[model samples]
Target: MPKRDRSKRTDPTAVMVRIVVADDGTLTVSVDGAPYLPPEFSPPWRRASFPAIVDAISQQTGRTLRVDVIETDGRTITDFYTPRTPRKAEPQTSAAESSVQAASAAEPAPAPRLMQFAGSGMIPGEEVAVAIIIAHAESGPDGIARTLIDSRYLEHSPTGEAVLLGRISATVCVGQPQ
Candidate 1:
């Protein structure tokens, strides 16, 4: 008889949660591609706020989890969540020292404005779908903003094989404070 290895360590897999937010603010949650319903005590979750749903899942999982939130405007936001660590006690400081520190701290830099353009050669008067997606992530308390997405129809120039053009404007914030 063959003996099996007995000392292997295996970690639990993180849960995959997906939520879709309707225009009316209703949220539908699915865990691992299956519908998830909290206990009766947690009814009305479909209408619960976004932060509330995140908190509930974080608490229930008690470990790192992945979440994908689909907004009403067709934007999909993805984020990872881990249980929060206990906060450390702040050292005692004089009012004067605290005020000085506050005054010396640098202001957050302003977000930069940017423009993106895309062109494709197509038959005259031909219409096609165009999508521009922007995403960002950060390991800070004040996390990144919701992703930007522009989806629309683009028509080719009415004359010759001229290119169809589309432009998307966005603001990107970088180097945010912790």
Candidate 2:
């Protein structure tokens, strides 16, 4: 009789935990950028802050974890890491190709100009769907005098053409390799 491979290692997978902390201290924890669970999972911490997550993960993985927070204009990027040895890559497409496939088409699509040409206003909430609304709609500035988006994003999308044609007058910079 053939023996079953009962080891959990047989179906090993990488878990990408993306934590987006809102300006208001609301945390969005996603596994591979999809909704996984709420921060309220912890009964101890005040609203399941970063330390709460670290506690949970430390208990589960038995490894020390560290998180780095960096503030970029209109965005907060966080990097999480541990001293544990990295997992083996799956036998499939490289990370670079797989990552871009979601952001763009298989064929290189023309970038957008003005970048939505989404002018401005604040929906001001946790839903990422707000971006979708901004993508399809343009608004007059709320007069807040703000540069809400990361400019390079506009230069690389179809919105770039719109920005150029409309004479939107926003700076779109292209970074040269060092």
Q: What TM-score do all the candidates reach, one by one?
A: 0.39, 0.27
Assess the local accuracy of residue 113 in candidate 1 as a C-alpha lDDT between 0 and 100. 42
Consecutive 10-residue window with the lowest summed lDDT within model 1: 160-169
Compared with the true structure, all predictions reach lDDT values of 0.49, 0.39
What are the per-residue Cα lDDT tens digits for candidate 2 across 27-100? 55554456645346543222224544555654555444444332123444445545355589887877898888
Backbone collision count in every prediction? 0, 16
Model 1 C-alpha lDDT per residue in residues 1-178, reported as the tens digit of each score: 9898878754567778898766655578887798876667865444324455667777877767788877666887787887777689999999999898888776664565433333333211112222312322111112212222221211222321211121111222222111
